[model samples]
Target chain A: MQRAKVVGTLWLSSAIEDIRGFKILILKDLSSSKGGYFLAVDTVQAGVGDEVFTVSGSAARQSEATKNSVSDTAIVAIIDRVNEENI
Target chain B: MQRAKVVGTLWLSSAIEDIRGFKILILKDLSSSKGGYFLAVDTVQAGVGDEVFTVSGSAARQSEATKNSVSDTAIVAIIDRVNEENI
Candidate 1:
Protein backbone atom coordinates (compact mmCIF):
# COMPACT_ATOMS: atom_id res chain seq x y z
CA MET A 1 0.00 0.00 0.00
CA GLN A 2 1.17 3.54 -0.77
CA ARG A 3 0.16 6.71 1.05
CA ALA A 4 -1.52 9.42 -0.96
CA LYS A 5 -3.64 12.53 -0.63
CA VAL A 6 -6.92 12.76 -2.51
CA VAL A 7 -6.66 15.92 -4.56
CA GLY A 8 -9.70 15.87 -6.81
CA THR A 9 -12.44 13.85 -8.52
CA LEU A 10 -12.51 12.63 -12.10
CA TRP A 11 -15.59 12.94 -14.26
CA LEU A 12 -15.78 10.41 -17.04
CA SER A 13 -18.28 11.10 -19.77
CA SER A 14 -18.02 7.42 -20.70
CA ALA A 15 -16.57 4.52 -18.73
CA ILE A 16 -16.34 0.78 -18.61
CA GLU A 17 -19.71 -0.88 -18.15
CA ASP A 18 -18.87 -2.45 -14.80
CA ILE A 19 -17.36 0.65 -13.11
CA ARG A 20 -20.09 3.12 -13.88
CA GLY A 21 -21.35 3.08 -10.30
CA PHE A 22 -18.10 4.15 -8.65
CA LYS A 23 -16.35 7.49 -8.39
CA ILE A 24 -12.84 7.99 -9.71
CA LEU A 25 -10.41 10.08 -7.69
CA ILE A 26 -7.24 11.89 -8.60
CA LEU A 27 -4.54 11.29 -5.98
CA LYS A 28 -1.09 12.74 -5.51
CA ASP A 29 1.49 10.18 -4.50
CA LEU A 30 3.11 11.56 -1.34
CA SER A 31 6.07 9.27 -0.83
CA SER A 32 7.74 9.34 -4.18
CA SER A 33 11.12 11.09 -4.32
CA LYS A 34 9.68 13.12 -7.15
CA GLY A 35 6.08 14.34 -6.95
CA GLY A 36 3.55 12.55 -9.09
CA TYR A 37 -0.18 11.92 -9.31
CA PHE A 38 -2.43 9.12 -10.51
CA LEU A 39 -6.03 7.93 -10.51
CA ALA A 40 -7.73 5.45 -8.24
CA VAL A 41 -11.23 4.27 -7.41
CA ASP A 42 -12.70 5.65 -4.19
CA THR A 43 -13.87 2.81 -1.99
CA VAL A 44 -13.60 4.42 1.49
CA GLN A 45 -15.65 7.45 0.57
CA ALA A 46 -12.52 9.56 0.66
CA GLY A 47 -12.89 13.16 -0.46
CA VAL A 48 -10.54 15.91 -1.52
CA GLY A 49 -7.55 16.47 0.83
CA ASP A 50 -8.03 13.24 2.75
CA GLU A 51 -4.99 11.09 3.51
CA VAL A 52 -5.50 7.55 2.38
CA PHE A 53 -3.74 4.28 1.64
CA THR A 54 -4.27 2.77 -1.77
CA VAL A 55 -4.00 -0.83 -2.83
CA SER A 56 -2.96 -1.54 -6.38
CA GLY A 57 -3.00 -4.57 -8.66
CA SER A 58 -5.58 -7.38 -8.68
CA ALA A 59 -6.15 -6.99 -4.95
CA ALA A 60 -8.01 -3.79 -5.81
CA ARG A 61 -10.79 -5.86 -7.33
CA GLN A 62 -11.45 -7.52 -3.96
CA SER A 63 -13.55 -4.60 -2.74
CA GLU A 64 -17.27 -5.31 -2.79
CA ALA A 65 -17.93 -2.12 -4.70
CA THR A 66 -15.25 -2.81 -7.31
CA LYS A 67 -15.23 -6.60 -7.44
CA ASN A 68 -16.83 -6.85 -10.85
CA SER A 69 -14.98 -3.98 -12.43
CA VAL A 70 -11.52 -3.66 -13.95
CA SER A 71 -10.28 -1.37 -11.21
CA ASP A 72 -6.52 -1.62 -10.69
CA THR A 73 -6.19 0.91 -7.90
CA ALA A 74 -8.52 1.67 -4.97
CA ILE A 75 -8.46 3.55 -1.67
CA VAL A 76 -8.60 0.82 0.91
CA ALA A 77 -8.09 2.79 4.13
CA ILE A 78 -7.90 6.31 5.49
CA ILE A 79 -4.84 7.13 7.53
CA ASP A 80 -5.28 8.42 11.03
CA ARG A 81 -1.71 9.05 12.19
CA VAL A 82 1.76 7.90 11.32
CA ASN A 83 3.90 6.72 14.16
CA GLU A 84 7.52 7.81 13.97
CA GLU A 85 9.76 4.87 14.58
CA ASN A 86 13.47 5.07 13.98
CA ILE A 87 14.60 2.39 11.60
CA MET B 1 1.29 -1.03 -20.61
CA GLN B 2 4.24 1.28 -19.91
CA ARG B 3 7.65 1.45 -21.53
CA ALA B 4 10.69 0.87 -19.33
CA LYS B 5 14.39 0.16 -19.52
CA VAL B 6 15.68 -2.80 -17.62
CA VAL B 7 18.51 -1.54 -15.39
CA GLY B 8 19.42 -4.50 -13.26
CA THR B 9 18.29 -7.77 -11.69
CA LEU B 10 17.02 -8.49 -8.19
CA TRP B 11 18.01 -11.61 -6.31
CA LEU B 12 15.79 -12.59 -3.44
CA SER B 13 16.97 -15.22 -1.05
CA SER B 14 13.41 -15.17 0.28
CA ALA B 15 10.32 -14.84 -1.88
CA ILE B 16 6.66 -15.70 -2.20
CA GLU B 17 6.23 -19.45 -2.24
CA ASP B 18 4.65 -19.58 -5.65
CA ILE B 19 6.91 -17.07 -7.45
CA ARG B 20 10.23 -18.76 -6.77
CA GLY B 21 10.77 -19.85 -10.34
CA PHE B 22 10.95 -16.40 -11.94
CA LYS B 23 13.65 -13.77 -12.33
CA ILE B 24 12.95 -10.27 -11.01
CA LEU B 25 14.20 -7.31 -13.00
CA ILE B 26 14.57 -3.73 -11.87
CA LEU B 27 13.28 -1.28 -14.44
CA LYS B 28 13.42 2.46 -14.84
CA ASP B 29 10.12 3.93 -15.96
CA LEU B 30 10.77 5.66 -19.26
CA SER B 31 7.37 7.29 -19.53
CA SER B 32 6.58 8.69 -16.08
CA SER B 33 6.66 12.48 -15.93
CA LYS B 34 9.24 12.13 -13.19
CA GLY B 35 11.74 9.30 -13.44
CA GLY B 36 11.11 6.33 -11.17
CA TYR B 37 12.25 2.75 -10.76
CA PHE B 38 10.27 -0.37 -9.98
CA LEU B 39 10.57 -4.13 -9.89
CA ALA B 40 8.78 -6.54 -12.16
CA VAL B 41 8.74 -10.23 -12.89
CA ASP B 42 10.54 -10.92 -16.17
CA THR B 43 8.65 -13.33 -18.37
CA VAL B 44 10.33 -12.62 -21.71
CA GLN B 45 13.99 -13.30 -20.80
CA ALA B 46 14.83 -9.61 -20.65
CA GLY B 47 18.35 -8.63 -19.61
CA VAL B 48 19.96 -5.45 -18.37
CA GLY B 49 19.88 -2.51 -20.81
CA ASP B 50 16.93 -3.98 -22.70
CA GLU B 51 14.02 -1.73 -23.63
CA VAL B 52 10.71 -3.34 -22.77
CA PHE B 53 7.04 -2.75 -22.12
CA THR B 54 5.44 -3.85 -18.89
CA VAL B 55 1.90 -4.78 -17.94
CA SER B 56 0.66 -4.12 -14.45
CA GLY B 57 -2.20 -5.30 -12.22
CA SER B 58 -4.01 -8.55 -12.97
CA ALA B 59 -2.90 -8.44 -16.57
CA ALA B 60 0.60 -9.28 -15.33
CA ARG B 61 -0.63 -12.66 -14.24
CA GLN B 62 -1.95 -13.59 -17.65
CA SER B 63 1.50 -14.91 -18.60
CA GLU B 64 1.64 -18.69 -18.15
CA ALA B 65 4.84 -18.42 -16.13
CA THR B 66 3.31 -15.95 -13.71
CA LYS B 67 -0.26 -17.25 -13.63
CA ASN B 68 0.27 -19.13 -10.39
CA SER B 69 1.98 -16.34 -8.50
CA VAL B 70 0.97 -12.93 -7.15
CA SER B 71 2.79 -10.61 -9.52
CA ASP B 72 1.58 -7.08 -9.98
CA THR B 73 4.06 -6.13 -12.74
CA ALA B 74 5.56 -8.15 -15.56
CA ILE B 75 7.64 -7.43 -18.63
CA VAL B 76 5.37 -8.47 -21.49
CA ALA B 77 6.98 -7.11 -24.62
CA ILE B 78 10.27 -5.69 -25.85
CA ILE B 79 10.42 -2.44 -27.74
CA ASP B 80 11.46 -2.69 -31.38
CA ARG B 81 10.98 0.76 -32.88
CA VAL B 82 9.11 3.97 -32.28
CA ASN B 83 6.82 4.93 -35.17
CA GLU B 84 6.53 8.70 -35.57
CA GLU B 85 2.93 8.89 -36.73
CA ASN B 86 1.45 12.06 -35.32
CA ILE B 87 -1.45 11.41 -33.04
Candidate 2:
Protein backbone atom coordinates (compact mmCIF):
# COMPACT_ATOMS: atom_id res chain seq x y z
CA MET A 1 0.00 0.00 0.00
CA GLN A 2 1.06 3.60 -0.64
CA ARG A 3 -0.07 6.98 0.66
CA ALA A 4 -1.75 9.68 -1.42
CA LYS A 5 -3.93 12.75 -1.10
CA VAL A 6 -7.17 13.29 -3.00
CA VAL A 7 -6.82 16.34 -5.21
CA GLY A 8 -9.88 16.43 -7.49
CA THR A 9 -12.78 14.56 -9.11
CA LEU A 10 -13.11 13.43 -12.73
CA TRP A 11 -16.39 13.09 -14.58
CA LEU A 12 -16.37 11.37 -17.90
CA SER A 13 -19.33 11.58 -20.26
CA SER A 14 -18.05 8.49 -21.97
CA ALA A 15 -15.96 5.74 -20.40
CA ILE A 16 -14.94 2.19 -20.93
CA GLU A 17 -17.61 -0.42 -20.18
CA ASP A 18 -15.74 -1.92 -17.21
CA ILE A 19 -15.35 1.42 -15.39
CA ARG A 20 -18.73 3.01 -15.88
CA GLY A 21 -20.81 4.47 -13.05
CA PHE A 22 -17.86 5.12 -10.79
CA LYS A 23 -16.64 8.30 -9.17
CA ILE A 24 -13.05 8.75 -10.30
CA LEU A 25 -10.61 10.57 -8.04
CA ILE A 26 -7.43 12.46 -8.78
CA LEU A 27 -4.78 11.57 -6.22
CA LYS A 28 -1.48 13.25 -5.52
CA ASP A 29 1.07 10.55 -4.81
CA LEU A 30 2.33 11.28 -1.31
CA SER A 31 4.84 8.46 -1.28
CA SER A 32 7.00 10.22 -3.85
CA SER A 33 8.97 13.42 -3.36
CA LYS A 34 7.98 14.55 -6.87
CA GLY A 35 4.31 15.02 -5.81
CA GLY A 36 2.97 13.38 -8.92
CA TYR A 37 -0.75 12.78 -9.44
CA PHE A 38 -2.82 9.96 -10.90
CA LEU A 39 -6.39 8.80 -11.08
CA ALA A 40 -8.06 6.09 -9.03
CA VAL A 41 -11.54 4.93 -8.25
CA ASP A 42 -12.90 6.21 -4.92
CA THR A 43 -13.74 3.14 -2.84
CA VAL A 44 -13.81 5.03 0.45
CA GLN A 45 -15.48 8.32 1.21
CA ALA A 46 -12.45 10.41 0.36
CA GLY A 47 -12.43 14.14 -0.40
CA VAL A 48 -9.90 16.63 -1.60
CA GLY A 49 -6.84 16.85 0.67
CA ASP A 50 -7.82 13.66 2.52
CA GLU A 51 -4.88 11.33 3.09
CA VAL A 52 -5.61 7.87 1.79
CA PHE A 53 -3.87 4.61 1.03
CA THR A 54 -4.35 2.81 -2.27
CA VAL A 55 -4.01 -0.57 -3.91
CA SER A 56 -2.72 -0.91 -7.45
CA GLY A 57 -3.16 -3.51 -10.22
CA SER A 58 -5.85 -6.15 -9.95
CA ALA A 59 -5.83 -5.58 -6.21
CA ALA A 60 -7.89 -2.49 -6.92
CA ARG A 61 -10.66 -4.76 -8.14
CA GLN A 62 -10.70 -6.58 -4.81
CA SER A 63 -12.38 -3.69 -3.01
CA GLU A 64 -16.12 -4.10 -2.46
CA ALA A 65 -16.90 -0.86 -4.23
CA THR A 66 -14.69 -1.81 -7.16
CA LYS A 67 -15.15 -5.58 -7.07
CA ASN A 68 -15.00 -7.16 -10.52
CA SER A 69 -14.38 -3.67 -11.85
CA VAL A 70 -11.56 -2.77 -14.22
CA SER A 71 -9.92 -0.10 -12.14
CA ASP A 72 -6.15 0.21 -12.31
CA THR A 73 -6.02 1.80 -8.84
CA ALA A 74 -8.41 2.32 -5.94
CA ILE A 75 -8.43 4.34 -2.74
CA VAL A 76 -9.03 1.67 -0.16
CA ALA A 77 -8.54 3.40 3.19
CA ILE A 78 -8.30 6.84 4.69
CA ILE A 79 -5.41 7.58 7.04
CA ASP A 80 -5.70 9.69 10.16
CA ARG A 81 -2.01 9.97 10.94
CA VAL A 82 1.37 8.45 10.22
CA ASN A 83 3.73 7.52 13.02
CA GLU A 84 7.16 8.44 11.73
CA GLU A 85 8.85 6.52 14.54
CA ASN A 86 7.62 3.17 13.19
CA ILE A 87 10.25 3.19 10.40
CA MET B 1 -2.25 3.21 -24.41
CA GLN B 2 1.10 5.01 -24.06
CA ARG B 3 4.56 4.94 -25.62
CA ALA B 4 7.62 3.73 -23.78
CA LYS B 5 11.11 2.35 -24.31
CA VAL B 6 12.40 -0.81 -22.72
CA VAL B 7 15.38 0.04 -20.56
CA GLY B 8 16.23 -3.10 -18.60
CA THR B 9 14.97 -6.31 -17.01
CA LEU B 10 14.14 -7.00 -13.37
CA TRP B 11 14.54 -10.36 -11.68
CA LEU B 12 12.93 -10.72 -8.30
CA SER B 13 13.94 -13.46 -5.90
CA SER B 14 10.76 -12.73 -3.99
CA ALA B 15 7.49 -11.50 -5.41
CA ILE B 16 3.78 -11.51 -4.67
CA GLU B 17 1.68 -14.61 -5.35
CA ASP B 18 -0.01 -13.29 -8.50
CA ILE B 19 3.13 -12.67 -10.56
CA ARG B 20 5.40 -15.61 -9.86
CA GLY B 21 6.85 -16.59 -13.26
CA PHE B 22 6.69 -13.41 -15.28
CA LYS B 23 9.72 -11.38 -16.32
CA ILE B 24 9.29 -7.79 -15.21
CA LEU B 25 10.61 -5.03 -17.45
CA ILE B 26 11.92 -1.57 -16.66
CA LEU B 27 10.52 0.97 -19.10
CA LYS B 28 11.06 4.66 -19.67
CA ASP B 29 7.73 6.42 -20.19
CA LEU B 30 8.13 8.23 -23.50
CA SER B 31 4.60 9.58 -23.35
CA SER B 32 5.79 12.13 -20.84
CA SER B 33 8.66 14.54 -21.36
CA LYS B 34 9.72 14.03 -17.73
CA GLY B 35 10.49 10.37 -18.71
CA GLY B 36 9.38 8.50 -15.63
CA TYR B 37 10.42 4.88 -15.28
CA PHE B 38 8.05 2.04 -14.34
CA LEU B 39 7.77 -1.73 -14.31
CA ALA B 40 5.64 -3.87 -16.58
CA VAL B 41 5.25 -7.44 -17.70
CA ASP B 42 6.65 -8.05 -21.19
CA THR B 43 3.92 -9.83 -23.16
CA VAL B 44 5.57 -9.48 -26.54
CA GLN B 45 9.13 -10.53 -27.42
CA ALA B 46 10.63 -7.18 -26.58
CA GLY B 47 14.24 -6.16 -25.97
CA VAL B 48 16.14 -3.27 -24.52
CA GLY B 49 15.82 -0.08 -26.65
CA ASP B 50 12.66 -1.44 -28.30
CA GLU B 51 9.88 1.11 -28.53
CA VAL B 52 6.61 -0.27 -27.23
CA PHE B 53 3.06 0.53 -26.24
CA THR B 54 1.54 -0.75 -23.04
CA VAL B 55 -1.79 -1.23 -21.42
CA SER B 56 -2.25 -0.15 -17.83
CA GLY B 57 -4.60 -1.25 -15.06
CA SER B 58 -6.85 -4.31 -15.23
CA ALA B 59 -6.67 -4.04 -19.00
CA ALA B 60 -3.10 -5.27 -18.68
CA ARG B 61 -4.55 -8.61 -17.74
CA GLN B 62 -6.56 -8.85 -20.95
CA SER B 63 -3.64 -10.04 -23.07
CA GLU B 64 -3.67 -13.74 -23.99
CA ALA B 65 -0.44 -14.44 -22.12
CA THR B 66 -1.46 -12.31 -19.18
CA LYS B 67 -5.08 -13.41 -18.97
CA ASN B 68 -6.13 -14.31 -15.42
CA SER B 69 -2.94 -12.60 -14.22
CA VAL B 70 -2.69 -9.69 -11.79
CA SER B 71 -0.35 -7.34 -13.56
CA ASP B 72 -0.79 -3.58 -13.25
CA THR B 73 0.96 -2.92 -16.55
CA ALA B 74 1.95 -4.97 -19.59
CA ILE B 75 3.87 -4.32 -22.78
CA VAL B 76 1.26 -5.42 -25.30
CA ALA B 77 2.93 -4.54 -28.62
CA ILE B 78 6.25 -3.38 -30.02
CA ILE B 79 6.13 -0.35 -32.25
CA ASP B 80 7.56 -0.97 -35.71
CA ARG B 81 7.34 2.65 -36.78
CA VAL B 82 5.76 5.93 -35.80
CA ASN B 83 3.82 7.88 -38.40
CA GLU B 84 4.17 11.25 -36.71
CA GLU B 85 2.19 12.82 -39.49
CA ASN B 86 -0.90 10.68 -38.94
CA ILE B 87 -1.12 10.97 -35.15
Q: What TM-score does chain A of each model score against the native chain A?
A: 0.91, 0.89
Question: After TM-score superposition, what is the CA distance of residue A41 in candidate 2 from its true location, in Å?
Answer: 0.5
- As a whole number from 0 to 100, the lDDT of residue A29 in candidate 1 is 78
Report the C-alpha lDDT of model 1 over A7-64, residue by residue, as the tens digit: 7665442232444566666677776756566667788889888989998877788878
* Candidate that would win on DockQ: 2
lDDT of each: 0.73, 0.72
What lDDT does model 1 reach?
A: 0.73
lDDT of 2 by residue, A1-87 (tens): 679877766554323345557666667678978876666778888888788999887777776787755566789999988877745
Kindly report which residue stretches of model 1 are placed more than 4 angstroms away from their true locations once superposed.
B1-32, B35-56, B59-87
CAPRI tier of model 2 = incorrect
TM-score of each: 0.53, 0.54
Q: Give the range where candidate 1 chain A is weakest over 10 consecutive residues by summed lDDT.
A: A10-19
